[model samples]
Target: MRQVGGIIFIIILMAVMFLMDWYVYQAVKTLLPDNNLVVGKIIYWTFAAGIGLWIGFTFFTIMREGHISTRSQLSLNLFLTLFVTQLTVIIFLFGEDIFRTLNAVYQYLTSTDTGKAASLPSRRKFVSQIAISIAAIPFTGFVYGIFKGKYDFRTIRKTVYFKDLPEAFDGFTITQISDIHAGSFTDYDAVKRGAGLAAAQGSDLFVFTGDLVNHKADEIDPMMDSFAQIKAPYGQFSILGNHDYGDYTSWPSREAKQKNFQSLKEKHKKLGYELLLDESRLIEKDGQTIRLLGVENWGVGFHAKGDLEKSLRDVGQNEFKILLSHDPSHWDEQVKKHPKNIHLTLSGHTHGMQFGIETPVIRWSPAQYRYPNWAGLAEEAGKFLYVNRGFGFHAFSGRVGIWPEITVIELRKA
Candidate 1:
């Protein structure tokens, strides 16, 4: 039954791709010179056929190996780039078609003969030329994203003030990173550089919100040394994210899955991160202490294994508390409205959809549609949430304007 379903899905996908190719090709032909039409068609169809073959190979590889190779992932990104470009071209061409149809309808209403009314205007070469020209923007962006933008790590520093913050801990800094989907990484040097940047922050504490690996525990083994470079004066703490549980992939048995989960936890230990599972830790300075709580993966639409109540065990009502939860949805769904006051919540998992525009004056991402606090900081009722953009790319295999983020937050007593 599953195989049949898979076959059906692939058939539908190929049909859609073919339709897009045909429509885009029509516009493309308009731009081609009459003398070189044959050459242009050969080049365009060959490129499209290569993409189709790559997709088929990827699907077969996944079925056989139960995992996607880095090469296949990169190919997938290429496919997405071309797909987006085709959509842009199609949008312009579709508009032209609509205009032509509307003009034909208007002509029909005033025509002397019904036969003449059936004729529609030919597509304008100018429109096709403009469409292809505009499509280059996204094509260039995707190429840049694949080659350079994925490794374009940036350090974002923020300051959060709270009246209830422990006075002794004022000016305390924490460096946070999240969603290191190490399996998707092809460049170890860039990964190490990002980790080195985080360590250079020299923060009082360091924390990883979640997602150390994409599917398996072994995925992170290669990048272990890079992440180990990140340390803090206080300590480094971590919690699980949805991907950390290895739930997305299939295992031979339940025990195998459990073993992988255990191995992932040990990876954290080897990296010197205290793996906090529904637990709290006390950080003391100058004879005053604040609480740091971490919970397992919990989100509105994903795994909800995190225990906020258990993590808050023994936490004081008035103590300055910081919570580490992987998904920002936790803040909206539970953390903010909880009876106990969690002064600040740190989260990731959105990755700002790995594409967006962010600037001093404006910020926008498709991720915002799904998550209100998709990236950066949001405060309500004096409680704060900061969503780290993420440390690695995932399915898209690249980052655009959002970039990969290492966040440094300074806590102040107001």
Candidate 2:
């Protein structure tokens, strides 16, 4: 029944997409009238048909195969890029349509001399021209995102003040990255550069919040050496994300799934990270200490393997603590109001939807609608949560405004 419903949804989506293409085609005609640019028109419709067909094929493949191949990943990226371009054109053309309709209604209502009301004005050619011209911005952006933006690694530095922070660890720096999604990477050098950037931060401790792979355990094999290069004096530690459980994919048997999971854990060790599964570790510097806790993937509407209570075991109430959780939703639902004061929580998973605008004056992403603390830092009741945009791209294979991030956090004593 579920599969049938999925097929129905796909069919409806394809219909809507094709209709959008047809509407956008009218605007294309306005710019390059049927008489002109025969080859361009052929190219436009061919590309549109290709995109629509590819999108349908990709979804069906995911539904049947439980994962997308590398080629399909590229197709998804192209489809998304074209979708953004088409949607932009639609916005302009739709606005012009609204204006035309309103003008016709207004003329009908206030006509002092109504002579069968003049036929509704034809769409001005300039409107479609402007729409096509303006749409080039996102079309170019998506193209750039596909080729360069995904590897445009940026290191974000943040300093947080804590009143009760241990004096020895006053200037403690922790470098964090999450959601590697190794299987999605196409460029080995770019991945290395990102890891190199994190290593260059030279923080006191390094932590990976979660999501080492998209599905299978072997995904990280190629990049193992690259990531293993990032090491901190306090050592590298990590926790699992929902993807690490292999829940979204099909496995031949429970035993096969368990083996993949075990291999994933082993990969973490090979990368020099201690995979913390609902566990705690104390970092001591100059006889002072801070507790670092890591929980499994805990998220609302997703996996709930994280056990906050178990991770909190044997820890003091007033002890300074930092938690590594995969999903920001966990912090909102559980970490914020825990009986013990969890001073700080680091998370990823939202990836800022891998697209959106972020500037000094305004920060926005589609990820916000789902996870309130989607990107950057959020503080409530003196507890801080910093959500890394993500260290890698997934599913879509590209990022627009939200570039991959390498976070450097300095813990300062107030």
Q: Considering every candidate listed, which one attains the maximal lDDT?
A: 2
- Stretches of candidate 2 exceeding 4 Å from the true structure: 37-43, 110-118
Q: What is the TM-score of each candidate against the true structure?
A: 0.94, 0.97
Clashes of 2: 0
The digit string of per-residue lDDT tens for model 1 on 1-414 reads 766676677677777888899899999898889999999999998988888777866766666566666777877788788888999999999999999999988888888886663678999999999999999998888889888999999999999999878788889999999999999987899999999999999999999999999999999888899999988989999999999998878899999999999999999999999999999999999999999999999999999999999999889898889999999999999999998999999999999999878888989998989998999999999999999999997878988788999999999988
Clashing pairs in model 2?
Answer: none
After best superposition, candidate 2 residue 155: deviation in angstroms? Answer: 0.3
lDDT of 1: 0.91
The per-model lDDT (C-alpha) reads: 0.91, 0.92
| Per-residue C-alpha lDDT of model 2 across residues 31-127, encoded as one tens digit per residue | 7756677877889889888878878988888888877767778878877887889899999999998899989888888888857664567888999
- The prediction achieving the highest TM-score against the true structure is 2
Error of 2 at 119 (Å): 2.8
